[model samples]
Target: MRHLPVLFSAALMMASTATAAPHVVASVVPIHSIVAAVMGDKGSPELLLKGSMSEHRAVFTPDQIATLGTADLVFIVGHGLEAKLAQISGSEAVNGKTFIQLSDAPGIIKLPVREGGAWEPDDDEPAPAAGSEAEGVLAFDPHIWLDPENAKAMAREVAVDLGKADPENAAAYAANALAFAAETDKTSAAIAAELAPDKGKPFIVFHDAYHYFEKRFGLTGVGSISDVSAQAPSAERLGQVRDKIIAARATCVFREPQFDDKFVQAVIEGTGAREGVLDPLGAGLTPGPKAYDQLIGNLAESLKGCLGG
Candidate 1:
């Protein structure tokens, strides 16, 4: 105190005295969880969107950009999962910073991020111009965690990236990733077994978010309730879906965790088909240990309970 310091410079000095840990940011909850698991004590993880926030409609707040500008690494579910993430990665603040896209990782079965409508068969992929779903660009489905195998691959990639970034603690990073991968494998096996009795059965979902899930579990994506992220299907589309639901004898009508069930309920009206949520983002998802496990567990159990044994 006797040394007498300037206010601004003293503040800077105080900040300098306190160390800032390596910053890792993710675009969505699952990516955040994977990165957080890998970083463990190596870094503190920040998420741009919570579980309830739709990645498709995500916007960057000024503070979010400021935080992102300082991140050591930013994890994204690449393959055009979230268009905003690609925009952010190209920004001056993030230009050369390490941005890892999970879709490019190995062992992930990705599909074109588009919706097929009875109207035109399929629509264009979502674009970023305020409201654009034109030209049908091949955006990657960022919902990689739906398939536990992809989740394991993502964990390993996070490990490699973290270990490379912080070589001093590479061993710890590897250990965390290894442990997370093992957990993911168990989850994958459990989900497979849970749906095994109903394998090859067709089902109707609200959106196309579960393409990887269908492939993993050997089920048919009979139809969908939504035409795109921002647009709900018209009555005509719903009518076709109703016919398909009846034809497939689909026992369950699945709605996403965050969307309203009105349309799905409407589709199933008078047809004996029951409706429930199939949450990839795991709505009401608690942020703690066993939370991710519970999210997937609830999804499988919910599906089995609705569909059949």
Candidate 2:
């Protein structure tokens, strides 16, 4: 009878440990980095999208599906950025799991998806008005994590969700989130200094994926070779991009590492624009707590390298 109490206490401790660690899944690399940072040493979140897979074109394998099905919480960029995962997460199959949509995270700055290859000269474009898009369709650009401020907001959201899921480790999650926010602020300040000289310096991207980052640092992306869908630009679109490149005197034409650069060469030919590579998804980066900083820093370096800063 004396040993029974100790056995019961030991069993309770094991049960508490299990409940303290939640099985969280993140939809993409950046979000995964944020979630992983917030979780700190408590646990690591499973990353859904891996390698050079385009979030738009992601198709889950059986194992990934099982991961999603079993996760206690799933963090997504939302706004249809990961449509397949979003659909699966919302479906009745995963109804029991909680989804933290970063797009809806408080203090996130949302920008409407810019139209066409050549952007308007103004950066003050307003967001879509209420009821503008079809039901369940997202009209805003979903790359909300590019801005460090937005990333800070996402960290808070992740910390809150994790705290809810693992109340026993709630204080740890909150503290880790604060540390992540401080790191992001420091990184943001350094990047701002690095990019300050390049403000209003025109550049072209392979796709229109960096508006949040551009808008954050006052960098000007005059045009994109690919449209919003990342489809190869049509001949007409390419011609327009070429014209924009020359007209804007773009210093660099940035190609994404995940895609072929042949089209980029086609656009930059005779335009005197240097070709640079930008990997917004951190395709080459190993996923971890440090990835988000590297992703943003790499972008600044790529821009500076080609922009002659």
Candidate 3:
């Protein structure tokens, strides 16, 4: 009879522990997608930035800040991508949370910020005077999730870290990660095939943000309308871009929905070049586990639609 009471108590404790999953928070939609994949049905992570807002310009609400303060784990791309969120996450109130910056993950391939309408070697750009976001003009590209290979690496790291944070669900995390990696491989191959016809086809982007995606699928972005610092190009710089487009015979210039389209239209005006919209953040798409693949597929389709015959 005494043993029955002890058994009931043990069962109740186990149930309580099982339901107590870690509170996870992600800085952006793409990162949140990967984390959600790993988490599966275990739990859902809070996405800090929900829409087309650029991470560089994100300002958290008081509720969002409070959410970060209470998070058990927070995933971010790092390398100054989410400077504001990084600051908040590093505050003393959030000191207890485990922040996983995927940029520092093993096997992550870093590409330098392309400057002056060409791929600048990483060694060529001047170093940031300090780690401040204002001085991050020469920082390595932060859109790591654009490349499926890098996404796979990040998923592994996320699984490992999530395992560490919640050991009871360790095996589930590993299984989900493996599944995500396989899906990434399959989706990447499909995207590559879809984009194969457009390989080496030159294009222009609103900003120099798609280099990782371009580099991944053998596409060539000859120039970006915006500079590495996201500054509006000078009149002289705009002239240079127009000349570069004419020189490269680029058929299409891509604009991002998050940014103003006036510059894009002005650049392509009378040049006979078509304009296409590329949403790097998956702006209007529903945010969830499926968004990552959808985002990549959308890019490929957008490129093909504009550049392909």
Which candidate gets the maximum TM-score versus the true structure? 3
Worst lDDT 10-window in candidate 3: 1-10
Ranking by lDDT: 2, 3, 1
Model 3 lDDT, full chain set: 0.77
> What lDDT, from 0 to 1, does candidate 1 have?
0.67
TM-score of each: 0.81, 0.87, 0.88
Worst 10 residues of 2 by lDDT: 1-10
Q: Sort the candidates on TM-score, descending order.
A: 3, 2, 1
- Candidate 2, 1-309: lDDT as tens digits: 011000112333356755558777888889899999999999999999999988765778878887776677777886667766655654546544446677887788888778644743223333323532211234677778888899999898788877766788889999999999999989999999998988989999987789899999999998887754465566777778899999989999998877889889998999898998898999889998999999999999999898974
Better of 1 and 3 by lDDT: 3
Instruction: Judging by TM-score, tell me the better candidate of 1 and 3.
Output: 3
